[model samples]
Target chain A: MDIVIGVDIGGTKTKIGLVDQNGECLEQTFFRTQDFPNLTNYLDQIKITSDELIQKLGKEVNILGCGIGAPNASSKNGTIENASNLVWKESVPIIEKLKERMPMPMRIMNDASAAALGEMLFGGAKNMTDFIVITLGTGFGAGIVANGKLIDGYDGFAGELGHVDMTLGDGRLTGLGVRGGLEAYVSATGLKRTIMYMLSKYMVESRFRDVAYNDLHGEDITKAAEEGDEIALKAFDYTARVMGLALANFTAFTQPEAFILMGGLTNSGKWIMEPLERYFNANLLEVYKGKVKLMYSKMEGKTAAICGAAALIWEIQDKPS
Target chain B: MDIVIGVDIGGTKTKIGLVDQNGECLEQTFFRTQDFPNLTNYLDQIKITSDELIQKLGKEVNILGCGIGAPNASSKNGTIENASNLVWKESVPIIEKLKERMPMPMRIMNDASAAALGEMLFGGAKNMTDFIVITLGTGFGAGIVANGKLIDGYDGFAGELGHVDMTLGDGRLTGLGVRGGLEAYVSATGLKRTIMYMLSKYMVESRFRDVAYNDLHGEDITKAAEEGDEIALKAFDYTARVMGLALANFTAFTQPEAFILMGGLTNSGKWIMEPLERYFNANLLEVYKGKVKLMYSKMEGKTAAICGAAALIWEIQDKPS
Candidate 1:
């Protein structure tokens, strides 16, 4: 049997797993990302954990490569360059360190791009040559696949769909200091802000009204929307409208076959999906009408992160440098 | 000698030329586009004129192919699908008809895509893999070249950069009926609207105040800006700010090595370019700072259009279908 090691590095936790071609995660473990103050410490931990896995299972299965996904990572040089969420203060040449530990082919890319590769290889977008995968977590991020390959721009920053300015005037201030970006309106943080704005603008009283602005999260709105809370429903509606419109704008540029949605916001299921579909179709150009489909990611929870990491290596292996 | 025939179809004139491998236009001629009210008539005239050119120079040179450029043309199907600017009311199977007459390898591409290929082949972008060519004429159009190829997407409309929504609210209405699109602001037509908006918003007095709205063109503002007219200066400044901001936004997505400007607006020269360069650099992400260059198209006037059309054939000869 052959397998690839998939590693997803988040601010709080890092997940490592062995993934097969069928998109199965055979075995997995986790460690605290914050504990590693620098790249050396992080690589040391990765080495120890991987060695333990190899000792137990490496005898039976051959390891192909290691695929890693981290915030602000560079695929070209395999470096995590100034990821704000990570404790590493400067650029970390993680691939070089990983090579020293295992002497294997290893690559790193932005987490969102990994997720897109995951979808193309194992999830909802297996058949799609041209489509976009948008992840809605604490923030919104996207990966573009055009011509059956990742649209990794010259700087490996091709699919910053959420960063596009959707606001004409004063809107939400993004962490990047730009205002009215789609991420500021569609992500978990953006959803909470929408709830707050709905509370003030419509004076809609519902269960969500009981939640404080700072204390609120994406789950609360999903919970309330399930309970048929008016404010919660309104908030999702607003989020969907903005999401749909942004997808329309995006379609004019790439005319993707579908947009696969992933992340915590997807918990609301049809509540968020229906309006998004309606508005996306409505805003699309007449020529492109009823063409681009909106789909939910088939890869869920830990499966998404693990499969995406494995797919990263599978994707670039055939690419011409 | 080897040559390709280039045909650029515009609203007022149809320019046809013989382009050699060296990017030289050996000979050129024009036909009144208004004279051909139907596709049949247009093709009939094209066949006769081209046959004449072949008879005169066929012995001296080898004509490899014919490349045609027009608005609303689809490269995938080689058809002009309902070009609003053209007299033909339905889809025109242009390549099929042109091939029937010439019996040589022929192709059709969106004019902007042809321009991008032209730049890569003959203009300033020969060595670059990732770059964009923007034609700012009556409308704004873009052609994206990444990974040493065009980003043609699933369909052929991959590089409609001008249609991106720049305004959060109702700013300007595009021909496509979208509001505040980049095309509605940065184009030569958009520049005139900016002037009109400036006149209404600032109530400024300048030479441009006397020109009727219908009579005003982009050159008037360029002429006025040269004379240091306050209103015209403000208009170009405003247009540059919007254009630069849009390019900055585009850079985040593509991270091209440069953006080559073509079409009538380039005639404004440093008046439009200096501000565009200033703002494009200012708004780019920190990593992309000073990386994307702002370049003027090397081909000028009819040369750009003719070379672009010829380059369309040259481009596809080596591409994977």
Candidate 2:
């Protein structure tokens, strides 16, 4: 059997896995990402983790290559450029360093793109040729696949779906200095904004009102909704409605087969999916009505990002070079 | 000297031409499309024209094949289904009909898609791998090319830029019964709407005041703008501002190398391009700030569509089969 190394580099921790073609992680481990503040230190830790995994899997499987998924990582440039959350202040040529050390075929893609590839290779989108995958984390990000190939664009920053402007008026402003961007209404941050607005608008008492504004988090709101809180429920409905309308607009542009959603937001389950389906179908054009499905990522905890990283290698082989 | 036949079928006229590999029309002729009411009559007329053209150029050139560009044409199914402007009420199997009559290699594509092929083959985007060609006529249309191929979705309607929803509120309604679509703000019909709104807002007396509301046209506004009409200038600015912002949103999605503008609106020249460039730059994301260029189509009138039709055959040969 052929095995591949999957690496998911997060702000606080880095997860490494020995993965097979079927998206199964035979063995996996993690290290404290924050412990290594600089680029060299973090890279050294990655090398150590990879070497340990290779030594254990070497006897049973032929190692194919390694796939790394990183935030702000560019596939075309093979560099992680100025990731705000990471300690690396400058662009790190991670792909070059890996190639020099291991001297094998490897690829580094944006985390969202990698997750999309994982969905196509191992999750619900296995049978779909054209689809969209969105990771609604602290910030929203997307990976768009058209006609069975990921859209890398000329400079490799093609799938910036989160930044698409929805309106230009006195709506919410984004980190990118744009007003009413999709991210301003359809992300975890956006959901929190919705929660704040809901709390202010409705006079009804709720558990969310007890928490301070700065202390509130996404999970707290989800928990509140799960516990049958009205304000929280309305917040979730607002987020899902905006997201569904954005998805419907995107559908009009590319007419994807489905939209695979990952990250913390999907944990809301039917709260998100149910309202999303209603708005998506309502806003979709006549020809595309009821055609595209909204699906949640099927990969289990912690493994989802790791599986996506490893799936990148498999996806390269699946597509025509 | 390889030669190909290019056919551009319009609602009123059909232009047929024998084109060379260099995108030069060797010979051309046209016939009134309204002369024939049914698909059979129009197709039979096309066969007759092709025979005549071939007979005229047979001895001097090596004929390759034929290419046809039509409205609401689906390259995937090779059928023209319910084209609103066309007289044919039912779906016409255009490709099959052409194949049976000519017994040669041929392909049919949407008019905008064909025009995009023409631009790539003979215009400013000759070296661009990813770009968009937008035709702003009676209706707005788009042909998206990514990784050096036209994005024909699973159902052959992938690049519907015109129909992309621009707003979620009670904005301009499109002929297709959609609200706030890009076409509702950027096409010839959209321009007329802009003019009417401008006339109502400002108390300025101009040539437009003398003309009846129903008799007003897009050209009247442009001509007035040329003669220094304030309302007309505002109308053009509004159209450009909205279109530029939409292009910026599209840039965030696909991040194409350039946006090539064609059709009647390009005749407005700097009034449109200047504002479009300014707004496109302002609304663009940081990384994509100076990357995507907005270009004008190089293919001249009458010949442009014809060249595009013939270029479809060449495009097929260029791509790996």
For this target, which candidate reaches the highest DockQ against the unseen true structure? 1
- lDDT tens digits, residue span B44-137, model 2: 8888997798788756677788888876677888877655446775578899987887777788887778888888897777998889888887
Native contacts retained per candidate? 0.54, 0.54
Q: For residues B1-321, could you state the per-residue lDDT of candidate 1 as single tens digits?
A: 888899988655787888888788877778988899977889888877776666766567888899987876778888887554567756788898878878998887877888888998989999998888888877787888877887776777677766677765357777767777778888888888888888898876788778888899777888899998888888888888888878877776667889898888889988898888887776665656777888888886767887899997776666787
TM-score computed on alpha carbons, candidate 2: 0.87
CA lDDT of each candidate? 0.79, 0.80
Q: What does candidate 1's lDDT look like per residue over A257-318, in tens digits? A: 88888877787788889898887776676556766788888886756876798888767666
Winning candidate number (lDDT)? 2
User: On residues A1-321, what C-alpha lDDT tens digit does candidate 2 reach at each position?
Assistant: 788889988655688998888999888899977899876767778888888987876666777888988776788989876564467755788999877777767888877889888988898888777888888875677888887888888787777777788774337877566777887788777888888899899988899788887788878888888999999999988888778778888885667888888886777778888888888787776656667888778887668888999998877766677
lDDT of 1 at A234: 89
Provide DockQ values for all models, in the order shown. Answer: 0.55, 0.51
Clashes of 2: 0
For candidate 1, the per-residue lDDT at A160 reads 64
For model 2, the stretches where C-alpha displacement exceeds 4 angstroms are A1-3, A10-14, A29-65, A82-106, A168-170, A314-321, B1-3, B9-16, B27-65, B82-106, B317-321
Error of 2 at A118 (Å): 2.4
